[model samples]
Each structure stands twice: as structure tokens, then as C-alpha cells.
Target: MSILGSYLRLSAADLARAVEQPGWAEEFRDEQTEREELRAPSERRLHETGPAWDELAVLLGRCDLPADLVHGDRPLPGAEDWGYGPPRLLMPEQVAAVERRLADLPFDVLAAGLDPAELGDDDPHALDHLAAEYAALRTFLARTARYRHGLLVRYA
Candidate 1:
């Protein structure tokens, strides 16, 4: 089974609701990805970053970026394991903090530390693809901060 990373932008209001009723975040993801039929996925923005996210997260930790940005500060209150466990919820503040950290960090230099052997897929271009996803994720978080939105990160 291939592990994949997914992210969904949540308005402040939606983030509040998700925190109050954690299960809502999963339902929201199902709705968004399904509604889009995943058409124009790039336009869907950072909706999915593939499995490279796992390795990327490790790299982030090595760079001293807070682990909560990807692994999350806490898991949503829910019983659903779904193979990869419950989704991670990052509040608007957490999102902003991550964006701020990304500001000075030359992500490419950090990304170079990623170990090819640790990648989920054996594709030779995995690192390059991960790099692109990293750039997109940074942009996505920046946009999320612009609107003061939070994020829901899920893996499956």
C-alpha cells in the first residue's frame, strides 16, 4: 500500500468547528476532494503532497522546524485509525508559525538532506518532486496565513 499525504485549507470558522467536533475535518476532506473529482489537482493547491511528505517531515525536523507543522500538535479527537490513524489539526496560529519559520529557511538546502533510501517510492525523481511539493506547501501555508486559515493534514 502506498502512503499519501493530504492537506486541506480550512477557514478560521471551519477550523473552530473542526476543533469543537474533530470528526468534521475528515468529512470535510471527503467532500472537497470528491467535489473536485480531483480535477485540476494543482489548482486544488496543496490538497495532496504524496508520500514524500514523510521524508520531508523528517527533513523539517532536522532543520529544527517544529514537528507539529506536519505531525501536528495533537490528533483530532476521534476513534478512526484508517490505517494511518486520525488526521492532524493545526490551528491558524500554528500555521502562521510554520509560515514564519519557512521565511528564512532555504528549503532547498534543507531538502537536500533528505535520504533517498527513506522515500516511500523508489522513483529517481522523488527528491525533485518532493522539492516542488515543499515549495507549494510553503506557498499554501503562506496563503493560509494571509487569510488566517488553519489546516487539516491527513494520511492514508
Candidate 2:
């Protein structure tokens, strides 16, 4: 029913008739069917992994907000230009670093272990949280790093 399914079906049909042998045609069709089945899910999973990592990064940051500013919105001083808002912002590089630090950790530990609520609202708290997250994020950076590696690998 899918485009790929149709393409494989057509290809298999052509391969079968081309040789004028019913058995060979059937074999060709079967192999194409299996190959197509494997390709689709592999591509889909690769596509889904990117957004999953982004979502995971966000969840990690939210669960670990600064401890001091545990209450309301107060400008985090010099971060106005940084777009990080009242709470300190996490940079892309820093996020990757945190994933690496926390990669070996079990998912639950990374998810629930670090309490952002413990951080202070002051500059010190923001800086400390950034440092910790940067460290921890390194652990989980494998997936994204692989995606990046693949792109460069293709050219090489």
C-alpha cells in the first residue's frame, strides 16, 4: 500500500517475468519483500531518534531548575541578550556535554536524580546548574553524536 511497497511489488513483478520462470519470479519477490520490510522500520527509527533526544534534553532541564529561584519570574541578570530568560539558558554544546556526562547513567537516574530545584536563583546557582548539566548531558550524547557522525561519514 505504501509507495515503497508499490515500488517493490512492481520491481519484483518485473524481475519475475523478465526471466520467464515462475519459481525465480517468486524468489525475487520474496527477497525484495524482506528487504523492503527491513529498510522502512530502520529509516523510521532513525528519523524518530532526533526529536526524542531534543525532548529528553528539555525534560532534563525542567526537572532541574535553579534551587534559589524556586518561586517566580525574576530576570536572571545578564541573560537578557542570551534569550535564556529569567532562568539561565543551556547552550547546544553544553547540552551535548551534559548528555555525555550522564550517558552511562540509567535513564531513571538522569530523569529523576538531579533536582534543579536545589539550584539558587543567584548567578552562582545558574552557573552551577549549567556546569552540572553540561557534565551530565555528555552521557546521553551518543545518539545525536552518531547522527552527526553519519553525516560526516557519508562524505568521507
- Measured on C-alpha atoms, candidate 2 has an lDDT of 0.32
Question: Which candidate leads the pack in lDDT?
Answer: 1
For model 2 the local lDDT of residue 26 reads 38
What ranges in model 1 sit over 4 Å off?
A: 37-46, 112-115, 118-124
**What does candidate 1's lDDT look like per residue over 7-104, in tens digits?**
78888888778878776766777778777765564345246777767877766776666547776667777637744988777888888888898877
Alpha-carbon error at 57 in model 2, in Å? Answer: 5.1
Looking at candidate 1, the ten consecutive residues that score lowest on lDDT are 38-47
Question: Which candidate has the highest TM-score of all?
Answer: 1
Give lDDT tens digits, candidate 2, residues 27-145: 54347545654674423111212112223344445544322111112322332222112222222343344445445555455445444444323443543444454443332234434
Q: Estimate candidate 1's alpha-carbon lDDT, on a 0 to 1 scale.
A: 0.74
TM-scores of all predicted structures: 0.81, 0.24
